[model samples]
Target: MVKFLKITAAIVILLLLFYFVFFKYRQIQANKILIPATTQTLFKINVDELYKTLAVSYLKHPSQYAGTDKNSIREKIADLNSGLRIPANIYIYALKGTAKNTLFTRLEIADTSAFNHFILKKLALLKKDAHFFESADSTFGLLVNKKTVSIAFNMAKEPIRHILEEIHDQNNMVKISDSKFAQMASLSDHLSFQDAENLSKINFTDGKIDFSSEFENKWIEPAAEPRHRMLNPESTLSFWLNGKIKSDLTEKNHTMSLSLLSKDSFFRFYQDYVDFEWTKTVTQVDTIVGYEYNDDFEQVEKKILRDRKIPSITINLNSDDKAVSNYLKSLGALDQSTGKISSAMIPLYQFYFRGSNGNVQLSTIKSAKPDVKRASSDDFFYFKVDFKKLINQTSIPLIADKLGTFSQLEIKAKSIGKNKIKLESELLFLNKDANALMQVLKVFQNGFKSALDLNLSVDIPVSK
Candidate 1:
């Protein structure tokens, strides 16, 4: 009797050990399916883990958790999860192959009985369509196995089985090439949650999602330029962008600096360049013998050599000293004392320049003394722009027409190490109650403010 009891116990222990090893191995295989071979876009959701989180939250704050019925939520969740083959993670992929546009999802099912009871049993209750042989929807297909199940939807007119077979084939997968994929995988593993990498890989074709048709050359490379160290190491943002500018003024390897200035400095520079109306001087000049009035003159001509400040504003630009000097020389800089240039140097000066001297007063536009701030480090440069002044003074039809719509605008950029730069800007509406961005801007002067707003940012990397 003792020997028989010991034998039974040993068999039970062996069975438990085998089951544990199989479960672990299955989990490893399931994770590998998250990233398929060929796919335009990928999405993942960890339903099991997410449910656990919600369950914990509900336990902590029962009042905050809302539900329509008073049924046992935990039991329902357990039943749903048990019905799913693989409840921990669900992966969704957008693929383009035999079918022009199709969506494929792979699910691992552990308990076929539970799944049938919850889904297939319920589906059985619905009347079947005789022509389609299943349900009225001809776009969906379900392939079931003892351990796994596959569901697919084809937006094209192609048969559903063809789309399902294509997704099931491992060789048909298309992979996205980017560091973002690796980062997403790392995040998913860390959090034990469902995560996605690239969903923008798809483009619309015939009102359906398809892979982008554009092809990028992988062989051609850009030649390296002699590394020019950052001018301001402590600057806010800095990076190298290798691209050609249309103008003949700058080289292909153009280094740009972004910085901020105080409100006073910004206003001072704007007023000097754009504010040019002449006021009648009250200073009494020595009476001099004047020529006799001509028939064209209405009265004693008030033309006199009156002293007035030139309409010139000095600003420290992002370019090098030599570049700044060349830019000024291009604008016909005449004054050597203060750094100032003629309004003619600025493109579209006709609309923005309000100077009375016209072409004759070109020399009157002198460079103001530049408030040059040296960079403490060779990393990045920083500067602020007064958009209010820009909107008021700039006469460029394209931007001028749009500037009045925005109530507040602020821009900031920062360099992440030597290769990447991050830029952020905000445009706020004066009326927070507005629904659309255009509406917010149009009514910005009306003192309306909305809690909702539009925001955008970008991260750029410069290759070494």
Candidate 2:
């Protein structure tokens, strides 16, 4: 009995040692994939883990897969699994100062030959060299090595090469093992993102999408008063900002609240009331007609229709200096008799305005009044959007249909430590029991079906 007990203890110790060694090896391997310090936004995804999570979610809500070809999707997923390395991570990132259209993606390749064949079968190749290829009308470029594949979208070949070179240089890249974002990302098996100012982690569970971000800088300063109490709870969209932000819109440090009453009213205020000619340049088009007198007489000119939109938002500004209001009044934007503010240079809509206790309220709604509700006292910044109410109030079918998936979105920011702030955002879905990712998949599937139905119903005249 003593010898048996000794053998059992020895086996347990060996297993423990193996686990620690394996974990450390994975950490070292992940650290080898370096990211450039100048990267503006980065997204890390665990491919195999995400697939497993999605599979479980699908089992829980099988109804969401209705009207879709399940076999086709399974086959595609299987093909991807065969080409990429399992239990590894893929990174998608954007660099600072680069165009918004440019993006970079890096993935671990399990089999180089298989991945190369997979790419060739999927994309419409525009050009190809030894190990480099351009596809999708030259908008996408791919560089495949033995163990890794790097892809760049909307980027030239030279720039992609330069970034690849920089990533291999230790001094030019960030140390992934020491990065806070990397540590947070490793905690979750799904997806995580890091940007210049913030590191965020996303989790899908409990029937809602929970996203949390940690700010690198003190973006939200502590407020002197509970300014959140000044916002109306019935507003479709409400935002509160209390910080010293240097912008042309405001000079001094102040607290501001912006509220939108309803989606219908907001759209109407912009489409029918706001004057676009004052700030926007008119787009003109030239057409060729018939030649009556000369070649120049055949030319006809017409202005293109402008579909400009601005939100019907109310602004509440609390500050010691009233320079903003004075400037508007000086420019004839505010009507002293009715206490209304109109468009600059040209009057289109007379927005309601009132001033009391050094607080200014300007809104497009005629019945706008001061109503306050204290939601939180500690949060320096808060934003909320009632998607259900907005959808119910909107006359546009497309906007209503797309936004119907979400019930509400709320975000809050508070100081966590010195020069650090925590921002938490929650998006509530209509189906409270379904997984957030499954709900998102349903949204896309339904949208595609609707588009197909619309196309089929359209009456296209047959060409003679």
Candidate 3:
């Protein structure tokens, strides 16, 4: 009887102790990575947080970048403090996502150089030393690898092709077999007959596209330039796309490659929005995030409980997982998705983009009817976009969920036909739960409104 009482008392004490160490106290993830030979200690920062900082940057500046040298731009990161003797131990990694926008007034009135010129400007700003930074040499800046993609509308213009040939100074371009009508069909169909039919009005009659494009050479980081040995120059990554409707989109399988001016830019893109873009090009993704720590789980668990107050604890070596589950349940990130925030990847075992697509179909059914004049027999729907910007300002819940789940996800994408297409996000899970996965998908389909219909707000899932 005495032994039983003693055992009960010990169990109760241990339970209380566990709560104080894990739930009540803050937690941090500690992992291992190979760094410069000069480093004394290395810290594994959360990839999700770092990416949020970047999402915020591009979201805030919608015009895109014009130069590569962004020293002033680097100084603008609000979260990253100035004058650091060394880099912080907290390194966020793998920031990635795609924002949808419309093409307005093509550069040549007919030539669409938005992807080449405008996108370059935005990317240049993102890779600038001031933005992709570290507190010091050993301060440890994460190579934030991000990809910026935009599909141009006026791709059908013959003159636009000629101008591109002139710009590249090469006439060896091969023609892509995809048809214009098929390409445009996948985008928003709000392009009224007046817009789609009047192709002649938007095309450049001249053999050249006479539009101004800004370029900045400062995109190359001098220090990170020499360290390009990690990633292979020629490697293909795969992606999965998800939407309410199943697609037969072949061209969407091929992704546009952007070779950066510097190695730092490459890593920066990877860190900022890794597989977020690469993996979402084909179907849905079911992610699994497993921890890889330097020490054994049992020993680390004890020490983690001892030091819970100073930093914070995520579900990892120290986590039993039950505490995290309870925490997430209270936060309402479990089965019931609240909205965009509900789509976010948070805590351990979170979900993203599983909710349903808010689909809106636009069609010119009346015009194509037999009685109508000059009616063509192709499907008549193109997306219409009325929004502030294609991309958001910070790390959204969906993006945060993506970075938290996978270490190096390979995201790939290409433009789907004429539609101003907004592909759905992929799923990132800490573990595999097919049932919860299905429920999340239903939520997304019901909650998320199609970006084609209206203006949307930027959802910063983690900060709030």
Clashes of 1: 37
Per-residue lDDT of model 1, residues 25-127, tens digit only: 6544545554455554555554443444444544654443333355454654564454775544456766535353566786767677886565545454222
User: Cα miss at 446, model 1 (Å)?
Assistant: 36
lDDT of each: 0.38, 0.58, 0.24
Per-residue C-alpha lDDT of model 3 across residues 53-88, encoded as one tens digit per residue: 334434654332222343444444322332221111
Q: Model 2 misses residue 280 by how many Å?
A: 30
TM-score of 2: 0.63
Report how far residue 215 has shifted in candidate 1, in Å: 16
Which model, 1 or 3, shows the larger lDDT?
1
Q: Give the TM-score of candidate 1.
A: 0.35
Error of 3 at 206 (Å): 23
Q: Largest lDDT belongs to which candidate?
A: 2
Q: How many residue pairs clash in each candidate?
A: 37, 0, 72
lDDT of 2: 0.58
lDDT of 1 at 392: 50
Cα RMSD (angstroms) for every candidate in the order listed: 16.6, 12.2, 31.6
lDDT preference between candidates 1 and 2, better one = 2
